[model samples]
Target: MRKSFCTTAILLAFGFVSSCGVAWSADAPLENSDCVKCHAKVVHENQADGGKHKTEVGCLDCHVGGHPPSTPKEDIIPQCSMCHSGEAHFELNNCLGCHQNPHQPLHIVFGDDNVAACNTCHPAQVNEIKDNPSAHGEFDCSLCHHDKHGYIPDCMECHEPHRPGQTYSDCITCHRVHQPTNVTYGQDIPNKDCGACHGDLMDTLAAGTTKHATLQCVYCHKDTHGYLPACQDCHGDPHPQLMMKKFMKCTDCHKDPHDLVK
Candidate 1:
């Protein structure tokens, strides 16, 4: 009975109800309304862009132990690992570095230098840039994706197009931002894009009377940059075997594949 009296006295000292043989006021859990009264802005921010936190959790879920007056400020605060464990991203230190606000976890932001931080969740893109070294690979991820997380800057922001009036879409069609130097494009790429670098070859191909003039540069060159296909790969032994033996190379007679002689 003395122990019960002591407990009741302690509860009363902390401004809790003093009724004996009844439910102790300390046992009564704090409602969402109780938290909202003090932390309306935090609650509102969480509801606005909380992602899963607004739907899956509540006030008491994270901020446990007790509120101030009964518990210290740090005692009530929760760590990210309390709920977000078991993943490589979760294991990473300094959740606040990128997340910034616990209320809106998904609203990620990056500082001027966050390449190492970016590599945690985006290892594929980071690895791709590292493996394939280009001018784009040398800097931090935030240099390109500045202002906000997931923001993809236009290639034209840092680089001039190969031709005038070329859009960001056109730049990505040939040059992947991560590995920009290794130029590759599809069949739909026009001859004008090739003309940007090889104007002489493009002019020669355009002026040629052969069927090759009707084809796109990619149609002959195919997948990647600097690929030179032999005439035999397309037009195999147009002449007799005796003539082919005498002239093993097609270019020896044709002179130029771009402007073939009739």
Candidate 2:
């Protein structure tokens, strides 16, 4: 009776082992399609606006090992550092603060205090404000870029236009946002634009009968904001040597460059 029981037990054990081997062999490896079955929303978001992640990577690439039942929750969700390393921008903490959605990585949203993070990625813009100090530079980056990560606020939002109907395009023509005080413009700038600040001077030049009255403000001012040219630079020694020595400066006789006392 004992010999018969042992033979039966051996046969049952062999049968169980054979069945398990067949089942394991038949099972397929996990794929992105498999992940999409459970994580449809996440997959959709990634597909729509995941930036480099959508194009360069796959679901299995970031999330390794296995899914929830087999893998720990922490192990399934990969850290940003795993791929984004060796850069100052990558070193910033709490990436989710600005990049609120990991799936839609490029759809960034800036927090109230994301200036530090902004400086890491855009040091040139930050340095421009630092190198040339102004009232605009004193405020936080969020103050102006309050809407989103890459939002550019209109100058009219904070400042009234120097003159009526001056568009935002007109603001950038002379004022660099980072270094607004260090005003600069091109030769094409009209006298009216300059008159926005120098109203009295524009009026004086307009009323005068001198040749300077007909010329554009940029003709004399050139590219720089507060540039003052010497009278001799344009009219080099207009008078004889004897007269030049007596009246060393053109302004001495001419009185004012804008409206010369002819």
Residue 67 lDDT (model 2): 51
Q: On a 0 to 100 scale, what is the lDDT of residue 169 in model 2?
A: 91
* CA RMSD of each candidate after superposition: 6.3, 9.3
Per-residue C-alpha lDDT of model 1 across residues 1-262, encoded as one tens digit per residue? 4336536665665434333223224566566656554466898999899987778988778888866546777988899888889877777778888788888988887777777777778899999999998998888888899948879899878778889988988888888889989999888788998899999999999899988888898988899988888777888768889888987677787778889876
Model 1 error, position 210 (Å): 2.1
Per-prediction TM-score to the true structure, in the order listed: 0.82, 0.79
Query: Which runs of model 1 end up more than 4 angstroms from their true locations?
Result: 1-29, 244-248
Instruction: Kindly list the per-residue Cα lDDT of model 2 for residues 1-262, writing each as its tens digit.
Output: 3234324443564432332222222255567765554456899888889898888888889889765434567888989999999988999999877778887787777767766788887889989998998997888898998847668899988899999989999899998999998889998787889998899999999999988889888888888998987777888766889877876577888889898887
Task: Return the TM-score for candidate 1, rounded to 2 decimals.
Answer: 0.82
Model 1 worst lDDT run, 10 consecutive residues = 15-24
